[model samples]
Target chain A: MFRNIFVLFAASLFCFASCKKTTPLEFQPGDKGELEVEFDNVIGGVNLQLNTGSYTNASGETFKVSLLNYYISNIKLQNADGTTYTVPRDSSYFLIKEENPSQLITLRDIPAGNYTGISFVLGVDSLKSTAPVAERTGALDPAAAGAGMYWSWNSGYIFLKMEGPSDVATSGDKKFRYHIGGFGGFSTPMFNNIKQISLTAPGTSMAEVRKGKAEAPHIHIMADASKVMNGPMNISIATNTTVMVSPFSVNIANNYVSMFSIDHIHND
Target chain B: MINKKKSIRARLGITIAVIVALVSLGVACTKTSRQERKPMPLVLPSNFPAPIYNLSSNPITVEGFELGRKLFYDTKLSRDGTISCGSCHIQGSAFTHHGHDVSHGIEDRLGVRNSPPIMNLAWSQFFFWDGGVFNLDLQPIAPIENPVEMDEHIPNVIEKLKSDAQYPGLFYKAFGEGDITSSKMLMALSQFMLQCVSAESKYDKVVRKEGAVFSAEEQLGFDVFKAKCASCHSSDLFTDNKFHNNGLVPSMVNDSGRYRITLDPKDFYLFKTPSLRNIMKTAPYMHDGRFLNIDAVLDHYDHGVQVNSTLDTSLNKNGVVGIKLTVADRANLKAFLNTLTDDSFIRNPQLAEQ
Candidate 1:
């Protein structure tokens, strides 16, 4: 019985794949352009490089970025005609790690059109993040994803993970690690940690690519690392060093969410 | 006026016909839905509440469940390949460590608390004594990673499984891929655990109107239980699935129970009310397994309740501490609790190692 079911499932999958191949691609009479989303980590206008080993926060606490990674998803580009083109769900969510060679996120297959603004979710939505482990694939798969971002103790994907040694040390361990991500586990609304941010392009018309062409202008997004510890809540390393999923983690998450804004969009 | 009355009668007749048709259609649809889904082998007693487990996420397959059963008995999951899940949870004793007040793990390392029996886990929303782990799929992690328990890291276990010749094939058969994952392993274990339904007791037979009658003493005991214990141990499942401070004082061990998880003073000494399905067979009751048998448990309820701020308000009757029960009442209650023992469940060969 098991063998029969397996055979049928395999056959169905094959049929589905073949059907997709037979189907024609739906493309408008316009060039398919690529949008590059870049992240510039800085500290008070000074460029903040990862693993450089020393940087000070607004609270006079010096720290280093041993690891920094987060999820950016649900990207949408607004056209000049007020119409929006959304990035497909299957390949939308991107895991941005500082150590990765490609700091610039290249979103392909975007139809050539006059775009004004771009908006995206800073973290994976609850619907996908909270889905059963079996359903997830590729980058979203918890086991294959981040080294320390996924909580082994529970069913949750840590949205923002930052770990490094800090000067503020009251205990034996001087390392500061913040794993922030929680949605719908607690009754409080503040515990729902997914953040949504929008950035309006500085230019009136963001891009205009020629027909049958690729590679469009880049959207430069400068994310300041200093704001993470020194935003609305002045998080001191001596007291509040690490948070997994607590009220303090929520405050830290808020700071990280506010750190991103489109510096400028290059159309040239 | 006569024409208007006739028209109204016709409309009523049409409405009744439509309602009948809709009802029949709905029944037919339900029947087909049941057929399509292939009624779960895991028997969900008609009287029990809808299972908390989201079945659609990881539907139980015969091959998968069998694989899980094999893994449950296999000691490869442990550090030295000595202690398996079955080591603590023996089948004849309702899947609990019989005679042991507290559970010991790999290398005879003692754990802090008693190992609770595994039965009807489909209905359990929260797991463990403290109710710290909410998801059932994640519950195994607590035992697997506990230094005193299996003492095996997840990655190490996966590596071991990959090396094993049999496990790779089993994984492929169960999940359609040889790639063994922590998710798949956990889900397969859940599938096996979910099928451990213990509703074939004499009490269930009586409740099901199967011509089985309860003894007079049992009937009386049940009435007493309804009046006193039914609030926390509610319905056929015999659990309200809520945490309560039943006045078990925090010992020198400082086992604060639920408060350790929630970090709230109100939740101090609170523990998830365990289901009393096979309460008679599974001796050494309570989270710490302090009480030896039913008599000690009843005695505690009657007089030994420690008065504290977090004491369950229901147990406090008219400002009097503990429950008021006579010796006769205790005996009768014990008789009724014994009727909950399902002989068929404990002796089931399918659940045991082949």
Candidate 2:
């Protein structure tokens, strides 16, 4: 009986070892998968339709967004097992436009895991903002991809740009322009509006990135446009129509910090 | 056995020596290849402080500087192809828009401020009167994009260069086989501007004891200048490179100067200190070009300083609003200021637009 029990135990150990080798529940070191973070720009729970959608702010001013663009960079994902995966900084920067259909940031070669949380910077970091011009290619290219999103005079990228027409706007064209950017000054300390955003999947709806999966999990993130004028401080269009590099821009930046939230995760 | 051991040791020594010789030969070959592209030397005057610009990042090369010169003189950079960087910044006027109180850009669009001289820019930490641009590599974009200035988009300029018959080849020679990128273009422009060193003035000669001596009156003027102006125009570069409110009244546009850039209340009406080097050639003086001549500037310092919340403390020493000047002091000071004129720098054929 003792011999039989020992044999069974030895056989079980071998089986366990083989099973661990072949059908491991956790991803191997070299295993990689893809993830898609979709930025859905919305205005007060409604899908934002650029140029036609009318939205009212907390200040009771109705407005229509003509254009909207913002930079999302330095993406990081946290695994359920406490391991963190950082997307390579070079491939991390994304400029999301309201008009662009490609709002889905497809993160390729991400280690297969159950990602529980996501974190990113809303604006270009100071280091990239001041990096040598050659390194600033792709979305960060000032003249080409970036275009009007850069402040040529100020020597920095305008992280978030929202322009629209409002009856209450004091500008002659009845347009309010908010060009928010300042990555702590290069030589001296200045207005730093780079906002860090972190969001966790809601209650067991974590993104399950698998190597052989038919489709990558899509993380739906809602960026509310109304938060620009309604967050923390109620910014009235009549009072401030054009806000660029100003002390008041800090308040606008503060309001927009709470704009992003993970609505759902599609692990199909 | 001892003879065999010695032979082995001799062979090892010869092997090591051969490897060292081969490595040195490879290094020499690389050095020869590097010397194929002649490096244009940046002027480092013995009297001046070390330059603020890092030369290692953008080494001045003959081809790159020539390309920059061509670009500087090219009107294609502007929207209408009528105005170039050289149009506003004339080399004869110490690279300033001479006699224009405020420079006019393409289609005679008047700019609000005076065209600051491009001389001694390598020493400058910030560009323009308001210190808006910190890096020299990023300065050209401002004028290129400003509606009143060149009024041309950078991408368009790059496109134009790519199609140009001569530009692509020139760019290739300068930056080596790459599409005409704005980064390479800007670096090339900097290579030319960095060589615009204005340290060959008579004052420099006198200081260096290069057989040039200040006259008695000029010496007296120097003493007065040392007492009154040298604090702001501190180094041999002739500028502290710091912004200050020199007490000029706000213009019709109500230009807030440094406050516009920093958005700090304390920085109100603060403008960068104009360098005293080639000060005679770069007039009318002041940020707005309100003073037409050196005497007007001196007169302003003597009586026209308007007190404000952010006026420079040096101007308000012991409640005296401005520097006091006597008749002899004015004459001698003028004589000393005149000695700062470096004719060779402004007239250098190498820096001229080809």
True interface contacts reproduced, per candidate? 0.18, 0.60
> Per-model C-alpha lDDT, please?
0.79, 0.89
lDDT at position A182, candidate 2: 93
Number of the top lDDT candidate: 2
Alpha-carbon error at A76 in model 2, in Å? 1.3
Tens digit of per-residue lDDT, candidate 2, span A6-78? 8777765754564432332445457888999999999987999999999999999999999999999999999
Task: Work out the TM-score per prediction.
Answer: 0.79, 0.89
Candidate 1 lDDT over residue span B210-230, tens digit each = 878999999998999998899
- Cα displacement (angstroms), candidate 1, residue A117, comes to 3.9
Poorest 10 consecutive residues by lDDT, candidate 2 chain B = B29-38
DockQ of each: 0.14, 0.48
List ranges where model 1 is wrong by over 4 Å. Answer: A1-34, A40-52, A99-111, A114-116, A152-154, A186-190, A202-217, A263-268, B1-40, B78-83, B99-113, B130-134, B145-156, B251-268
TM-score top scorer? 2
TM-score of chain B of 2: 0.90
Root-mean-square deviation (CA) per prediction: 18.0, 10.5
Q: Which ten residues in a row have the lowest lDDT in candidate 1 chain A?
A: A19-28
